[model samples]
Target chain A: MKKTLVIDGAPQNCALTRTPGGMRLLVGERSFDCALETLGDGRYRLRAGDVRRDVLLAQQGDQLWVHVDGRTHAIQRINPLDALAAGGRGGADSTLAPMPGTILTVQVKPGDAVKSGQILLTMESMKLEVTITAPHDGEIAEVLCAPGQSVPVKATLVRFAAKAEATP
Target chain B: MTPQPIRRLLVANRGEIAARILRTARARGITTAIVRHPDEEGGLAPRLADDCLTINGPTPVAAYLDVAEIVRVAREWGADAVHPGYGFLSENARLARALAEAGIRFVGPTPEVIELMGDKIRARNFVVERGFPVAPSAIEADDPATFAQRALAVGLPILIKPAAGGGGKGMRIVRDASVLEAELATARREGERYFGDGRLFVERYVERPRHIEVQVFGDSHGKVVHFGERECSVQRRFQKIIEETPSPVLTPEKRGAICEAAAGIARAAAYVGAGTVEFIYGAGGEFYFLEMNTRLQVEHPVTEMVTGFDLVAEQLRVCEGEALGYEQSEITAQGHSIELRICAEDPSQGFVPATGTIHLLREASGPGVRVDSGVHEGQRVGSDFDPLLSKVIVHGRDRREAIARARQALRDTALLGITTNTAYLDRVLAHPLFAAGDYSTAFLDEQAAALSGKDEPLPLDLLLAAAALSDRQMVDAATSVPAIYAAMGAWRN
Candidate 1:
């Protein structure tokens, strides 16, 4: 079975496929051939070129766990559509996506000084908002996107002219 | 006592809690040997342990909960004692008995104590039999006829709790009896799946009762003690989001009574360990025993600060053949303390766990402030574990002062690259009920909107701050600019 793992909230995707007698994986644009076998119990031994390592893994049903070096890591699986669980509903005043969700609300106009952490052009991905907030005390320098704009992660929502006190 | 002679210890758990306990152990000259999953290493255990052994192999069941594997590790590492943190085998009586049989000291209560308290129905019955106030509860028969009869008498809005489970799972409030039969069936199934005991119990849901839990310590010599109480009123989905000591609403008389009752329960159980007796105090000051956790709690640090005692140290001492440090009269409740769980979730959303890279991290600090964290900058936080990133604990001379100080600490805390509940915590600490000490388990569920203000219009200044930050990122990165095609020959020339 092949599984797609989204890393670091980035749009980039990683695919891990277990093959017969071997393993193939794709990370970003890179591809590699590897050997994978269950060491014992649930432990797996993965050998890829010069890198040979023994890994202990636990898949929390849907969540993923991988050990690299000596440190263990738990990478959670997030549905880009359920960001509203953070409690911020979709549809706050038209400026921001409200929560860290995919942009679903775009209510503000250009030169809208979204106070601080104010609603800017809203972006909703996993039900949470990328509702870009006012980064510092400032006036609305520019509005980069319009309402219903589905921007990718890190897409600029609005620009602010830094306030007098905001400058060091 | 020469500081209870230090020696090697085995921490039998995982995640942030295990990490926190190891830090405390290391500070006092105790060597730690952590049991690691075949694939699971690093975290707090690798750095904290002087020795390490892989358990059952790799799967969480194979590793963390594999009591046999854990016993083998302790024996191989020559660990004289094993400290079961919170989850997994922490409250497992059979595991505790196994450790005792293996001649290894279990840092929690005795196996017999674990068995008694681990059984929710029996525990409740025992406390009530001793004349302690237990929420009026009765088990509904599995038979639909008897269950319906029990449901009708129990009335609507009763809490159907699995007689054998904790963590608020296998629980539901049935406002309409029409669904009681199905609800009972579902609860029984879940209870059996989780706790292996599908016994269903009914309790009149005490709406708006503040979820207060008393920290109690007992010794092997049958000496039981109470160290005041913690207000863990702020929660969602029955999970604690914030906790504090010297509950805001407790008068000296009320506090004394509550603590006394908690100690009574511990004493009755012959409980010998660091444990918490959770109670639900009604609006009128009538408190009911929710249950007793016969192991160290997740929020034991706040009690440590208020009382100036390292509870785990006491646990270590007592387990290592020491006497109870103080009597009830000797121990005094001091100051005010609060703990905010820094979760890895976006509060504006439905508190869904947010997985992201911690690009920046600056925790709160100052006089009477303590932060127990598992992640730092460059740390990869995910939902694979509990969403609690760290617990920010603050202390002050009084509750009001503590409230103000907690707000300041929250304001000072800034965790970027991922959303956190820091702001929501500020709102909770500022809530009138919380400040007035009139909170309950229903406080969040009832006044969630007012406390969190998820809908209150975002002020313009706050909006501007967000815009400015996003704008600045664009100006600084230079990566936002479109790629310009350069004529290879001309550019090279």
Candidate 2:
């Protein structure tokens, strides 16, 4: 079986093959005779030959968190269909509230052209001001929120029109 | 007022501090109650308390800050005293006054003292009038029209801070005079937004300053004493992330001088209970009083570790009108101690706060190590409150061993399902400057690149393998075997 996992924002290919006695795991160019023993409660002991290491694991949706050697690493399992649906904007068709917050200001409106990285709006959450910016050069299709509006996480604040590709 | 024992205590805070206070209150045979916001139903503090009372407001943070609600809860819970811990209503005079009016003791200084030290401008003026060293500065309230000119005249590099600010919020450093005006406007806005006080103050920005603070305890009997200073120079966004006892930079003579100066300030204010006096020490060894916190400080654990004193117990004792039985000479500190604040933030991402459910929480434990944790497994971490999840404190015979233990403790800590600064703090401890004990308030800013951990490449293969094997679908697919092979169990080719 093969899987693609995004680690630290970069995708890596992994292949797993079952052997008579155990399992052989290949990640990128490295291979290991890996056997994982569950110690219960998100704890696992991984044995690769004579070397052994303890790891803690938890999963939320497609995101997997693994703690090894005192550091926690977040990895995402990439789904081909989800990637395809994201398209060029990478799923960023609208500015979403990063956390539960109240909008403090809006710098753009529908029909306004914005450059990449231009600040579109500002919101306050946890007593800290968060600025939402354009992911790429695009035209604003609609502004869904206004100043003093309260929003929850992932709430769409502004929608952008599809970027117009330049002719070569 | 006559001395009286607190029969019932209500902790008017949450998180580790509440747990910390409850530990002492319970140990002393005092009944304890803790306030819990609805969102914090699963938090560790409420679970530790003998009784739990619900507090409500529009937001979780607001609920904690609702002075009226907290007071009413304390009264209804039949608590004889209230411990505000730190932050929230810890420094709010209104809470103290309200608690006092209800005939319940506030486990801190008098409300008048809290109001005096709560205002930065008023506190600075008080310290200056008492003949304590202070930095040159200008207050916007003194003359709003000429505040800008006066601030510029003070020096080239000035720090604009909100009069009611702490925890590094609403503070800006203007090295270049050109940006002073703009920074002032931003500072004022932040001040108003965060603290509801737009009043501004500008002071001389000490270059390469070290933040050393003394923990002072006082009582109604007019007695005061000082705990050795804690060096909290390693700060981010104007808040201390790493703190240690017996500042490595101070000589014996300097330590005595600084500690005495702190005690002097406390004595001058007639301060009671637990309070911390902060000073900005320059490279030249000269120190200036920055501010005096009228409540217990967040970094009090480092001092407690070295002095072998339960500061909360001392606060309770003082609140009961008991004098500090021991004099400054009798109070002694031993060995070295260090504390690392485990915050749910990504240091690599400019320390922006991170949020997620704490799916697995294995706090570090071992000899010479203590973890004051407020989180538990399956608890959700959000930005509604401070990012601090816990503190990792280690004590050793010396600074070197303490540093080593701190590094080891960081490795032992395993908080999964949320991004934290544990690894970043480990890298910081590994820095040569930190290990050598040669640093200042600007150390983090100066060594930001080296401490960022970006230059170190992660072990992608190992991480990916771990992730893959732990994944349910991936593991199921990889481990599944043919029915024939399953039927031929125990037979190897």
Tens-place lDDT per residue, model 2, A1-168, is 456799878888765656667766766666766777889978888766556788888888888888887788899887556676666454338888876667999999999999999999999765467789998898999999999787766789999986666779
- Please report, in order, the local distance difference test score of every candidate based on alpha carbons: 0.68, 0.86
Using Cα atoms with residue i matched to residue i, what is each candidate's TM-score against the true structure? Answer: 0.70, 0.94
Clashing pairs in 2: none
Q: Taking the tens digit of each residue's C-alpha lDDT, what string does model 1 give over B98-132? A: 88788888888888888788878788889989999
Which lDDT tens digits does candidate 2 get at residues B61-174?
889899899989998999999999999999999999988899888898988999999899999999999899999999999999999999999997999999999878888999
Error of 1 at B353 (Å): 1.9
List where candidate 1 sits over 4 angstroms from the true fold.
Answer: A1-168, B1-6, B38-42, B56-58, B141-145, B452-493
Every model: Cα RMSD to truth: 17.8, 3.3
Deviation in angstroms for B487 in model 1? Answer: 25
